[model samples]
Target chain A: MPKIVNHEERKRKVAEACWRVIQKKGIEQATVREIAKEAKMSVGSMRHYFSSQKDLFIFSMQLVMDHVHERIKKLPLSGPPIKDAMQVLSQVLPIDAERRLEMEVWFLFTSKALNDPDLKKKSDEMDDELYQACRLIIEHLTVAADWKQETERLYALVDGLAVHAIMRPGRLHPDLLLSVLENHLKVIGQNV
Target chain B: MPKIVNHEERKRKVAEACWRVIQKKGIEQATVREIAKEAKMSVGSMRHYFSSQKDLFIFSMQLVMDHVHERIKKLPLSGPPIKDAMQVLSQVLPIDAERRLEMEVWFLFTSKALNDPDLKKKSDEMDDELYQACRLIIEHLTVAADWKQETERLYALVDGLAVHAIMRPGRLHPDLLLSVLENHLKVIGQNV
Candidate 1:
């Protein structure tokens, strides 16, 4: 019998290697040769997994979003709308090592997307997804007046905290992240 | 007489070129050769201004920070603390084309700084400066309780709005930005 390869698993492995390269060096250095070396695969084989660097980058960034979505889907939303919303939002934050890597990689891609139109589309889609999530949480919380403004506020606060946490994890600890978020929710709840 | 060249002026011109290259292409493309071409200078002469690309980048990034600082310093803060604070914060947002370029370049450098230790120090200093500014505004606002939390909240909100505005200027308009910010301040005022 001949050995068989899991194509999807191999692609995922390569994408993870790309993430490590992006984190260790800046995204600019995430070249195919470098990623191939990082992935412990021959460059020719790497091409088999991803036709081009752009394709690889798109897949890698999409993986980060998929991971967040997966985590959010798995969250045990045992009620009290604010707490459950917090649980959902926490899925996107860099609260743990795993999520931290995802957030960092996600942000690196976002920065790259500024000039790369293909990546820009992906970045915009993710932003819209996050915005919709915020809107959903606001609706669930029953924020009565100016809910649109409230949704924007909540979205900005979440992203700002995520950026700060990723940039300076020591200063913006998980406890403080939860505290800031909880306070915002409480204020919104009171507004209802 | 030998040519009277303004050393500082030439360097400023080169830095401005660097900023344009960064904004147009990504930061990785802001190489000495590319920046020299953009600035309409020879590679040999570019060396006289910045010994290395790293030196040029450092100077360029610092210029962005200095520009923001200069703008804030010149802001005519004819009071009503909340409005004054908004004016100070607005200087950092991408409200105009000039500021939008500054912000875009600033963010690109920030992402690069994650993997570059030398740039990391500069990025940290700017974050601390912004944090302190937020604290000052919070103090001026005289929020009696949890002022620290409030400061962090405000800082995150401003940065979050900035990142969003930079990413999707079409969606997050200047009007919406001010409205969201004004609403946050109103809520904080109510808390006090």
Candidate 2:
């Protein structure tokens, strides 16, 4: 009997390989050949899944967003309010090497989107998703205070925290990042 | 008599032209030829100032950091502390087209620095400069109770504000950005 491989799963594996190449050696190095080599497949096979370079690029970025969504879905949501909120937010930060790679690729794709129109659409959608998450966190806290003001403050802080984690991981230690986040929760008078 | 052109000034102008090209077009479009065209000179003349493409790229990036430093230096320090801090900090944010261009180019250069060893040295130096500025601001607030902690908080907030202003200009409006910065300074126990 021959081993069976899922086409969709193999496509995802190729995208993941592209991401690793991008994280380790800028996006410029994420050529079809390199990604194919990393995936342990031939360039011809990779091209069978992706018709063009743009297709692979977009799919790779979409795969990144999907991974983030998957991780967020896995977090234990049924917990104490404060702890749960922190956990949900921490899923977005680079607390571990995997998330760090995800963010590195995220940042690279974002810049690349500036030049590629198709990628720009997906990038915009992801931005909205992030803002929506922030809005949800704000609304949850607004039961105690002004939704408008608290929403603005919380969103800024969350955005700040995420970017700091990516830019200066050493200075913005995850524990310290969590403490400041917890402080904001207290300031907003959230029951958490 | 032939016009006496300042060699150093001409080189800076060429670097600035290179930045405009990179920010408007993608970095890949920022070729020596395009930069020369943007600067209204022949490629050979531009070469008189820069020996290679790499030199132009490095100088253009350094020019951005230098410009940011010059702007910060020009800000008047003898004013209401809150107002002065706001003024200085706002200079770093993408409030207008010029600074937006600067932010875009700064981000591009940062990504390039991750893989380019030569650029890495300059990036590390600038990173320290950014960190030192935060440290200085914290030290200045030492008269306040728990100023050490206050500094850390404000530093994170500023970093967050800077990134937000660049990544989501429309979402994080200039006024709101300034308001958050002001409120943060207040929390630092600064009297202004």
lDDT per prediction? 0.90, 0.76
Native-to-model Cα distance after best TM-score fit, residue B55 in candidate 1, in Å: 0.7
Error (Å) of candidate 1 at residue A181 is 0.8
Clashes per candidate (backbone, < 3 Å): 0, 0
Model 1 alpha-carbon drift over 4 Å, by segment = none
Q: Model 2, range B65-95, lDDT digits (tens) per residue?
A: 8988999998878676666767777766777
**TM-score of each predicted structure versus truth:** 0.97, 0.89
In candidate 2, which residue ranges exceed 4 Å CA deviation? A1-4, A142-149, A190-192, B1-3, B141-152, B190-192
- A84-145, model 1: which lDDT tens digit per residue? 99999998898988988899999999999999999999999999999999999898786487
DockQ of candidate 1 compared with the true complex: 0.76
Q: Relative to the unseen true structure, what is the C-alpha lDDT of residue A97 in candidate 1, on a scale of 0 to 100?
A: 84
Candidate 1 chain A, run of 10 with poorest lDDT: A140-149
Candidate 2 chain B weakest lDDT stretch, 10 residues: B144-153
**Of the true interface contacts, what fraction does each candidate have?**
0.80, 0.36
Clashing residue pairs in candidate 2 are none
The clash number for model 2 is 0
